[model samples]
Target: MRPREHASQIPPTRSASIETVLVVTMDHLPGYEIREVLGQVVSSQARTRNVYREGVKSLRGGAYDPAAPENLTRWRTDAVARLGEEARRLGANAVLGMRFEHREVGEMWMEVCAYGTAVVAYRSPAAPAPDQPLVAAETAHPAEPIDSGAIAEAPSAPNLRTAGETPTRPD
Candidate 1:
């Protein structure tokens, strides 16, 4: 009998376009994010922490213990993957100001929330301004704050298109 060829034997083409941006926000997950996306599956499981030498040392009166390193790593990886999946769903290429929040639910239960703003970012045409040295004012007198009315407001995009024309679209 002739040997059967499998689809996995074929390599992906180099011409394939790849998404350059990735945005992620996660809470907690059991399985890997990539696995979930590819396999279209997701699972959640509660994890427990084990006390260790470091955790014990850091605690006062030997009241605290360390958590399992393996479980911690796995949970973190899954959370990150879930966040990335969320960003991908939102059509965001990158995430900014990512932050995590931890909360204790019960005696042994802890919750972790990973969050950030996801956006599609592209390189700007102009270069950023150079850094400048700070200059202290010699006078101790306070300067008057600028009035809001004195500043010019940016023209709205909708108004720009109209340019003095009567409103064609209903409110």
Candidate 2:
């Protein structure tokens, strides 16, 4: 039998659709504040081995191209898309503290679950003018002086080496 054609070797599309839900592993967006909590959302997909493919793989014996499958890339794309759908359904524009879990189902199937807290995050309002002082001039705390004590009160320990010296291990 002829070998199966390889899936396109091009990089997989990594982004979701036009809505562009911000799904991330971090709990907080760096420049945005979470305006509303929309609760948790999740999605999953199952993958099973194809017996015909496995037979071909076994027959090829030691010919496995470790990186050929790119299964994670495919799975991640699917999971993220599904997660984005779920988040949108919950009226959330972003998923925060996102994480994934994987498990082997019985012997032949694998399942991946993606989950996170859904929330609406918006950029916080600009701050008040920088030079405006909040406190009265008389009550401002005074700066304290720094005092560095004298050095070399105790004898210097031995084996301090110069830049060119190789260090020796202690016996």
Candidate 3:
């Protein structure tokens, strides 16, 4: 078969759009500092099976797979996208502590929910150089210089019997 023409020209769907709002499971973003907590943002989507069709499929040995990976992924993506939209509306640049919950209503309906705390965040200032300590040298108390002679004259460990030698009991 000939190669498909203009395959790249098609615009991506809304669900597949570039994520503008950052969503992270961590309580805080590594390189970003949170400025304001907008509040909790939540999005839920529910899907129902066609009872008649599913019944027939099951009878014919082609049972519907509700827990299919693709279905679950799509559900999660859609829920998260909705959550991001809500966060954007709240003037948040990122969502922290994101969580996903799935619930089934009997055998017919499935619901996927995404929730997180929305916050305004900005990229944190660049970190100090590896060689530089977190605390300033001027404010910190200077470490005293070590005396090699003192260390050499320091008390040694207590005398003990060597291997295979029996220890004497104290009276």
Which residue runs of candidate 1 sit more than 4 Å off their true CA positions? 1-20, 23-46, 49-74, 126-171
Under the 3 Å rule for N, CA and C atoms, how many clashes does model 1 have?
A: 5
CA lDDT of each prediction against the hidden true structure: 0.42, 0.66, 0.70
lDDT digits (tens) for residues 91-140 of candidate 2:
67778888999898976788888999987766656643457543322123
Error of 1 at 118 (Å): 1.3
lDDT of 1 by residue, 1-171 (tens): 110121122222221221333433342221212212211212233444444553666666765344455656667555555554555455544445556556656655656555666544443434323464222221222264434555333333245656778656778
TM-score list, all predictions: 0.39, 0.59, 0.60
What C-alpha lDDT does candidate 2 achieve relative to the native structure? 0.66
Q: 150 in model 2: Cα distance from truth in Å?
A: 38
Candidate 3 backbone collisions, by pair: none
Q: Give the number of the best model, judged by lDDT.
A: 3
Against the true structure, what is every candidate's RMSD? 18.4, 16.0, 12.4
Task: Decide which is better by TM-score, 2 or 3.
Answer: 3
Could you tell me the TM-score of candidate 1?
A: 0.39
Q: Tell me, by TM-score, which candidate is best.
A: 3
